[model samples]
Target chain A: MHPQLQLLVALQDMTGMIKEVEEKGSELEGMGFKTAGLDDLKRAREELEGQIEPQLMGAFQRLTAKFGRAVVPVVGNHCTGCFAQIPSSFVSKTNAGKLQRCESCGRILYWP
Target chain B: MDIAEVLKNTSPELFLPDLKATDKESALSELVAGLTAGMDIKNPDTILQMLQSRESLGSTAVGPGIAFPHGRTLAVQRLTILMARSTAGVDFDSEDGEPTHLFFVLIAPPQDLGHQYIKSLATLIDTVQEASLREKLMAADDYEAFCAALRGE
Candidate 1:
């Protein structure tokens, strides 16, 4: 994977983690569980965001806000996020390590 | 290789019914605690963290009230599967926006060269995707019935 794509994948994973921790943090605190991981993940996300390209970062944030996941795997020519079948041309571009977005869902697509 | 065979190899002690947790984190902690008590796991906290990290990637809830929360960790010697059911349901952040009632927590070693881990995962996903089987599993009154449900009995 390209360094930028790798960074975006990391950022996406971190975003997911941050969301989960925030959503469940209060409930966990009520149960006496330490939520320090949430802070660490948030900081990590910020650091990752700094590494990604500005335009890509903006797109990522927008897609993540719209759909819980911004980067989705293309499995057998289908965008796993939206279950939409991607064109073979897009699949080839993704396989070539180009950062591409699904025409249907607008989520970043990668071949895993 | 089949899901029933996989469940058969897993300890009966891991199948839990009527789990009391009302939310995802508590439900996860409860399952990790069970693993700590029954298995050779040394650090429950670390294992819980790993599972939570995996959950952050996506809500494991595959749909129809079942969620598969899994992680690869160094704490286990082999692939370990723990099953739990919450009749009251828990907010697992499922894509369908419905409360989740069934959870299958799968823990695997960091290195699964034989590909047994993914195969088991695929089997679990295929098995649960069957609405009839899921219904039977959910309607089961006890562990034995649960096993029978998995066995397609």
Candidate 2:
């Protein structure tokens, strides 16, 4: 599948988790859970966000930025992406529209 | 092939072929439909249905003009991937208010290949983040041209 799009989805998930943690921290403050624990939680959230931001930004940059345009096409029983050996049978099947995977890389392949 | 070498071969033959769309679904449906068919999917309905089911769980539209819809299987054969470009673009309930022109669909088989799958996905993600590449693809007027531009030729 397109990797850039996948990364974006993953970033969204991380963002949601961060939001939940923030909410929990606020709730603890309201209920007087523990100052030290709440502080720790907030710190953890910041770290996570910092890490997530660069990755997500990079992913978005690639996707919207056009980094993966040259996705290879499988040709002559070889994976164009990984150049891995695809069985002759699998290659034929993929051509026949039955679906085939590269033995090495495992990405579903199609004839160019 | 070494991962680096394989990664370097960005020709249309590696991706952007074998996708057959019988009919156009909605914007999201188009993305799902294109990917399922592109992979020569085994159970197209299964993945399609799962994506539909996900809206009930929560929106797959993760914002930023991107959406991630995935499904599980007790006995999947292998992971399959599908990518598509909608020239006209579509609205996916994104936060950026930008029309989605690019899409990636992932189908994982029921095996312990999760780590490998993630690796392949990461590579794909890296590719998508290139700004110059995106411009070329957007300029493509047809599928053939699109494929060529994707290859950077």
Candidate 3:
């Protein structure tokens, strides 16, 4: 993966974790149970977000707002995020470590 | 935690005794659609993407015919859970190689506090640990039966 794509993937994962932690925290609070680790995850996400370029970050945020997950894996020449099959040429570009987006879903595409 | 209390706030309408999807992807889409229907979800497509992304990380199928397909997204106002059963069973890429029969779709907000969501998931997993409990849930004919079985009645 390209360096930026790598960072975006990590950022997406972190964002997902943050959401999970927050949900768990709310559940625990409802049960009168205390929890932790959410702040650290948020901080981590912030730091990760800061490391990416503004343009790329903007794209990520836009895609995330539109698709929930801005970065998704390309599985079997298909954008698993939207189930759209990409052309072989596009897959080659992705395999060559180029950043790509699914034409249908518009989520960032990476070769896992 | 008391299972009933933990799930008390969950909407009973989210539980589906007869899921209609024949595959994992379609099942997820169906579940998400059902969960977001009539709600103010900004983007149902995005929510489905989030859930699919999580599944790609690894199948949530724990074992014994149960799968917990969950995702965190800002599309919803708060944490939500939807449960469904596939009588015909669907391949969820379970590690155990068994077809998944029960699905607990959990959706949480991006900024959630974290306690209630985790606790609810843990409670659900623990409750279904009993083989009989799994059987009862699978055999439940209606929503009431499903709730009763979940409550260990």
DockQ values, each candidate: 0.03, 0.03, 0.06
Error of 3 at B75 (Å): 1.0
- C-alpha RMSD (angstroms) for model 1: 13.9
Candidate 2 versus truth, CA RMSD in Å, comes to 16.7
Tens-digit lDDT track of model 3 for B14-112: 887787887888888888887876355645766776666666545777757888776555455467878889999888877778889998877776445
Docking class of 3: incorrect
Q: For residues B1-153, could you state the per-residue lDDT of candidate 1 as single tens digits?
A: 897767854677888888899898898999898778767664466567667766655567766798878655545657888888988999998878899999888877534556465567667776777888878888899888997888778
Q: Please identify model 2 stretches exceeding 4 Å from their true place.
A: A1-112, B1-25, B35-42, B54-68, B74-76, B141-153
Ranking by TM-score: 3, 1, 2
What residue pairs clash in candidate 1, if any at all? none
Local accuracy of candidate 2 as per-residue lDDT tens digits, B6-89? 233233332442223322246446555555444444434444544443343343444243444443332134555445665566
Q: What is the docking quality class of candidate 2?
A: incorrect
lDDT of 1 by residue, A35-63 (tens): 45566567666887899899988888888
